[model samples]
Target chain A: MTITGKNKNKAVVESVAQIIFTVCASFAILAVASITLYMILSGTPAIFKVGLKEILFGTVWKPTAAEPKFGILYVILTSVVGTMLAILIGVPVGILTAVFLAEVADKRIARIVKPAVELLAGIPSVIYGLLGIYLLNPLMYKLELKIFAGSTTHQFTGGANLLSAVLVLAIMILPTVINISETSIRAVPPSIKAASLALGASHIQTIFRSILPAAKSGIVTAIVLGVGRAIGEAMAITLVSGSSVNAPLPFNSVRFLTTAIVSEMGYSQGTHRQMLFTIGLVLFVFIMLINIALTKILKKGAAEDGE
Target chain B: MGNDTLYQKRKRPGEAFLMAAIYGAASIAVLLLLGIIGYVFFKGFRVLNPAFLTTVTSSLKGTVGIAGNLLNTLYIIAITLLIATPIGVGGAIYLNEYAKPGKLVNLIEFTTETLSGIPSVIFGLFGMVFFGNVLGLGYSLLNGSLTLTLMVLPLIVRNTQEALRTVPDSYRSGALGMGATKWYMIRTILLPSAKPGILTGVILAVGRIVGESAALLFTAGSARILPKLGTNLVENLSRIGGKILQPGGTLTIELYLQMQNGEYEVAFGIGCVLLVIVLLINLLLKVITGNARKYGKQ
Candidate 1:
């Protein structure tokens, strides 16, 4: 076709449209960059002022005491243990459920169970909080009373403690684990299962030996995502945990990194406020680490699949 | 029994045990949902009344209700979607149709995933700093919606991308062969087909915004009152605009507050309302996705 004035106009419009689209696409990058920059800007000043050791190692977190101390050692430990424990409880049940959905369940059962799982996933975190408060906390308090009967550990804040938080986290992370794990489990090559079964392996053996082993990377990713979910959980945790910065004993009222920020951000000012941002920064670092590890696992999985 | 077991159909104890565990685990997931939903509906049923649904909390009249919170939640969902959908759709178009495989494209995709992974609390904190204070929107519906816009952007983008991907390449080729421009092909063909998926994404985003609380806590000050409005038509329209700038607590935030204030009755009621809303959302999603699947086959 011959180049003409109208054609030039069309060419210019296309390029301009492309530019606008590119800018639109870059918004995600812009958002991530700004979040990181702001986090560093707002979070680092507190770290420098408080000394990283004092903040991370200091056990006393009396932010509003006569002489305020801003240690988050207990806070860090609570998050670490809470996340780990939740992972332990959630992963098994979640993986087994995935196996059922992917390998065992009939179509009718899967159809019924699938929507329920999605609804569970859809339930608000705060509703989880409500459940924790009413259902789990009371049961925990009764258990605590029995276990610590005649002991001088005054059970304050009812049953809101580390254990309750963990249970809540476990339940909350279920949807993530089950969905991702199930998808990966289904993606396992049918040939692998067939081969294993043909080699005189039982059906259960084929699933455990061939299917799960093949789907390990996706399962691992699901677990990592679950950890991320548990670690950064705020609303359900804030309501469930006893909101005090304590060592993460099973029954102690404790605070996770995310809850520390949410509980204090409302009224906190100056250094107290900035330290809350520091907690966010700490939480951010943990999530980034998790994200990095996930990338490594996924890349390795892909490379292995290639081989 | 030993040699025949290898070739014969035999069940190991381990197999039975593993099978039991799988069934049991699936049951737990189902039970948890049933238990929570059942509990909320049971508790909230006692407290829910027509009056409870229709009025705001007024100390002078001594009426406590979630009307204000319900409205605020509706408003936030509307405003957030308004801001997020166009940008998200545009971004997805760029990703799926226009952009070549390159560093920038990969970076965008990675960031989108990261955004989804990032917790709401961080978004709340960032919103409190940037949008709430520095941007001078303060703790208002608009400010909260902006924060939520970021939170739900990934949903829209990913869903739109999936929808766009499902569109056959032949449509694009045919359009271009007919001398249509790239933008024309996308506008006339890709987007219309992608509408169902985009709608699904929007519905999902709505569900998220309805459920979200942590992000709104600091960014949107939890003021549980109806915003002021004008009486006359001209003034009423202007006042609706004014409502956008006022601080309002959504249903979830108000639920948290009620829980804090030891108002279990109200809290349970709010949770029940939220559950019902969630049920409705899931139903909508099921309908759209089922329709999309049916359409896909044809």
Candidate 2:
């Protein structure tokens, strides 16, 4: 009778512990749900007040005028353009660097280059902002004076503009694309390379035609990740993109979706603050789409590896 | 003749061009890294001194100090790690040790992945609204700490889960065979074995906290004042405790403000300090994990 009671007590304690653990493990789900819920609850009312068409498609963004306008079409356009440009510049360099590390470089060179890339990844975004301000801005300013010196248009062609933002973003996205692509290239099967070599293909030809084609999914995933980083980035772009809402010309100062929310969050109130949250909602949806793509690609890669 | 011709095939111009391009790209990446580091150090080293590290900002004295921000960074780090570590480790334990393979587990894992991918600016927005306004913390260090806890929790959980998986199953069975409860086995055998990983996660979280600016800017209002400690030990302790609920800026925010104010030299100094801290933490991580690897073999 005593032994049976002891066993029952032990079982009871064990079961209670399990219950506690289950609750703890659920915190991730809880956090995600709460963040999503909070964002939607706070972010949607502004969309209704501003009207979806005016908020999304309208061009003006006069939030504190006598009659307020809350259009984000230009902001969205700038983010897309800047990100697209960053990818165009970053992808080729990143992929080429990865190709060097994976296929061409000697071991010593690879070792040195690898850690440098990791360090690049670890540098804080603010530092990137600081560098952009200190270095890229001035260079662009001189270039602006030269290019538009004799032109008639009165443009504020200072260094801190869309082109500056694009350059900084391109550099920032390099580590993400390079690291992922390098790993994927390394994962390519040796047998395929051997087959190509046996078929009288040169090393470069084999790498381009066989290894790269085989690792296409991973390289695509890397590019997608780079695009996401470029679009979502705010602080560096905020510093260099001049924080003005304008058409995304090479010389014109432009505000991205991210910088728009951050630049005004401090002073904004009422419907204006609500609009910032609405912008946050838009950014959230963009991120969610990227995350979904990442997950799908990763799953596909894993399945392919399994086969 | 076929074998001889195949062996004697000359390198094509295209091959040479591709290789040169590859090398050029690699060189450019390395040069960029070196240039940034060299430039920061060259400029920052000139202004870095005892006065800058120790003093507080004084417009009248024409002096700038990051002492308050330094302390605030430490406070935020301590508070964030203290809360995040236990909760994170607990969650990992439940996921790795206790939970059965099922929908709930997968759901938790999926949510964790989703949480990590959400950008810092969004976290800043949420913290500004939820923590700053709704919680009535009103842009305090405590509010920032709470926000960061949420941000770093997934990182800690992922690291701890990875660590727990590395523990040999034999160790668990051995502890349980000796009449120990499951919790006892975990506390004694599993945790000790996974110490390196848990520590790594915590340290990496510390690095993230130190480097963080966006979330803190909203949650922790960038007040540059030092916490007012009284003239006694007990009073000072209470004052320090009280400071957690007050607005404070950290090093990164200070860096941002300095740059904004055109305090270029001071900003570079802070940047150098940040770089040094990152390097040190990375080294410490490597040492700890190296030791852990050695211990694992035994």
Candidate 3:
């Protein structure tokens, strides 16, 4: 009876603690639930009121005008084109740099280069924006003047354009691509290299033929992740892209989907504000697709390795 | 012999080109870092002064400073981590110890993954609408901290889970075998062993909290004012309750403002401050993880 009494207090405390933890553990689900609920609840009203085709396909996005056009076609196009350009440029450099780190560089050189990459990764997006404005814009402006000498357009952003945004994004995605691809490359078992060597394949030949193919899933994951980062990025692109809703010509100023919301979120009101949330929902859907792609690739890779 | 000659002829130039390209890529990565750091340090170092660090920006006083934003950054870090750490650590313990491989576990894991993958801008919008307006917190540090808690919970949970996994099963069994309850065992053995990992997660969360701008911009409301700091600790403590409800912008937000206004000199100065902080964080991370912390989306 005394032993039971002694244990009763501890048991109660244990049960309480367990309950607390279970609640805590459920926070992630609660957060996701709330976000999804809030996103859908807030994002759909504007679409229904404004018509989906008009908002998604409309070329003009003047949400505050008397006859306001809620078209995000140009904004969507800029994000898509800019993201593609960034991936096209960033992926090769990132993969090659990973190859250099994993298989090619001297241990000493790799050691030095590796920390630089970490520091690059650690740098804030805002700093990238500042640098874009500081260094990149001026140079691009000079080029713009040179290329379009005697051009009629009076508006010059001094380099704040789609080109600058793409370059900044390309650089930003580098560390993500490099780190994942490098880790994956390093994870490629050395036996694969040995097998290739035994088959009369030279070192570079083996890397391209055997090792890269082996790590293809990871490289693809890196690219998808890079694409996600580029699409979702705001502050850096906002500062550089000049925050205009326009066709995504290389030198033309533009607003990506992320920057579109940010550049307008401050003062946007009523339907204008609702439209921004709608823009966010579109972005969320894009991210969901990317995340699904990521999971699919990761799952497939795991299954293959299981085999 | 002919096959060998053909293979050799085809391989050399292509091989040489690829190798050169690899080397070039490596050089570009290095140069990009060097160029950014070099530019920031060169221009920003010249602009830094004790006054700029110490004072608040005032048009009337004809002064420029980041003292307010710096304090806000510190406040956000402290408040966000305080709100997040206990819940995060508790969640990790539950997931790693109590939960079995079941449907609930899978749901929790999926939600955690999905939460991590969501964009900060979306979080900002949600925080703005839900926390700032709907909940009537109305753009305050308290509001930002709450938003950031959700933003960073996945990180802490992830790192702490990894740490908890590293603690041996023997430790748990041994503690339970000694007549200790599960909670007691977790507290006494599992936690102490996972301290470094938990601390790493907390610190990384701090890094993310500090680096964040978009998420805080709307929720926190970029109103630049320093919190009260008098000699009386009691008075200060008492007033903090009232003060947290006031709006503030962190260092990154201020930096963005400066850049937007084309205030390069001040922007670079803020950049230098941020760079130093990030380097210090990475240095600490290197020590704790005892390895170069691999780059991943935060």
Candidate 1 residue lDDT tens string, B1-298: 4567545666488889999999999999999999999999999988899888888988899998999898899889999999899989999999998889999998998889889988999899888888987899999999999999998999999999999999999999999999999988988998999999999999999999999999998887788777566568888887777888999999999999999888999999999999999999999999999999998888
User: How well is each residue in B127-213 modelled by candidate 2, as lDDT tens digits?
Assistant: 877888888888899999998998899989999999999998999999999988897788889999898899999988998898888
Tens-place lDDT digits, model 1, residues A173-216: 99999999999999998899999999978889999989999999
Model 3 misplacement above 4 A: A153-155, B1-11, B228-235, B291-298
**Candidate 1 docking category?**
medium
Candidate numbers, best lDDT first, in rank order: 1, 3, 2
In model 2, the runs with Cα more than 4 Å from the true position are: A1-9, B1-4, B296-298
Q: Which candidate leads the pack in lDDT?
A: 1
For residue B7, model 1's alpha carbon misses the true position, in angstroms, by: 7.7
TM-score each candidate.
0.97, 0.95, 0.95
The 10-residue segment of model 2 chain A with minimum total lDDT is A149-158
Candidate 2: the clashing residue pairs are B55-B65
Q: What local distance difference test score does each model get? A: 0.91, 0.88, 0.90
Docking quality (DockQ) of candidate 1 = 0.79
Candidate 2, after superposition: displacement of residue B237 in Å?
Answer: 1.5
Candidate with better lDDT, 2 vs 3: 3
